[model samples]
Target: MSLYGEFSVPTDAFALHYTLEQIQEITIETERVVATEVGLTNYFWVSGCNLDEFETVSEKDPSIQNLRRLDEFDRATLFRAEWTEQVDAIIFAYLEIGATILEATGSHDEWHFCMRFDTHDRLDQFQDHCDDQGISFRLTKLHEITQPHTGSQFGLTEKQSEALVTAWKMDYFTTANVTLADVASELGITPQSLSERLQRGYQSLIANTIVVTPPSD
Candidate 1:
């Protein structure tokens, strides 16, 4: 059976360490990643800082290369960059073990990652590889993916599902009577965390359901 794992790692132990140090208030969330021959190409969103300053500081981040602005939103800017393969052993380990990164978000202090593995053995191998590389992380959650036609079917993590369901039950989408804070309180998590889960969950659902492409002829 497939397994899902959630982990947290300090920013200094992962990518964009220098950028985060320079811009303490900024937050980052990865949009996509593709493995290249020599490195990983990434698309991510950044907010809470000057985009130009973020670009300036990114030049000094040894983990990043070829950083470019891709799009601008009301609150966040999208960027594309190449991450040097040698700098992020944790990500490389995931590549080696065929683990899928479902979502990754980072702040000045740390990064939270949700990943899926084909089996328990693959998860174990990923942990062993991280240990061998001296890469440290806190495993916050882990569980087997037992149902494909339900929660995992839409690519939503357990936490995301909980947040979405709870918010729905509270009529968060139907009425203004319930606020994000109210839903967060019900879930026993901070509003910011709840917001992240809801956003990621929405994205997962849209990607898995609404954005499908028909098979090529």
Candidate 2:
């Protein structure tokens, strides 16, 4: 059976150490990743800082290359860049073990990741590889994927589901009794992370249930 795992590593252990240092209040979330012949190309959503400052500091981050601004949003900016593979052992280990990243969020101090592995053995192998590469991380959560298709069925990831359900149970929607911070505290994640999950969950729910395509003429 497949397993899902969540973990966190220090910023220095992963990419963007320099950028994180330069911008103390910034948060980054992985948008997408593609493996190339030479290295990995990554798209990220960055927020809570000035874009010009981010670009200026990114130039000094040895782990990043060819950083380009792809899009601008009200709260976040999209960036595309090439990551130096050799210094990113966690990503290299994920590729080696064929793990799929569900979500990744980073702050100045650490980067949190949720990933799926094909089996217990693969999860173990991934940890072993990271250990061998001198990468250290704190495992936060792990569980077997009892129903692999649940996410597709509900259009929500496990974390998103948990957040929505918990908030609903706490009367967050009806009475507005519980704040986003309260729900985030209950889920043991930052408010920003919970907000992102909730937003994505809402989008998924709307897309899957309400939005219907017109028939071809």
> How do all models score by TM-score?
0.71, 0.71
Model 1, residue pairs in steric clash = none
TM-score, structure 1 vs. true:
0.71
Give the count of colliding residue pairs in each prediction: 0, 0
TM-score of 2: 0.71
CA lDDT of each candidate? 0.80, 0.78
Q: Tens digits of per-residue lDDT for model 2 on 77-166?
A: 779898984345656655677777667788999889888888888888888877887888689999888874755344455667788889
lDDT of the structure predicted as candidate 1 = 0.80
Best by lDDT, which number? Answer: 1
Clashing residue pairs found in predicted model 2: none
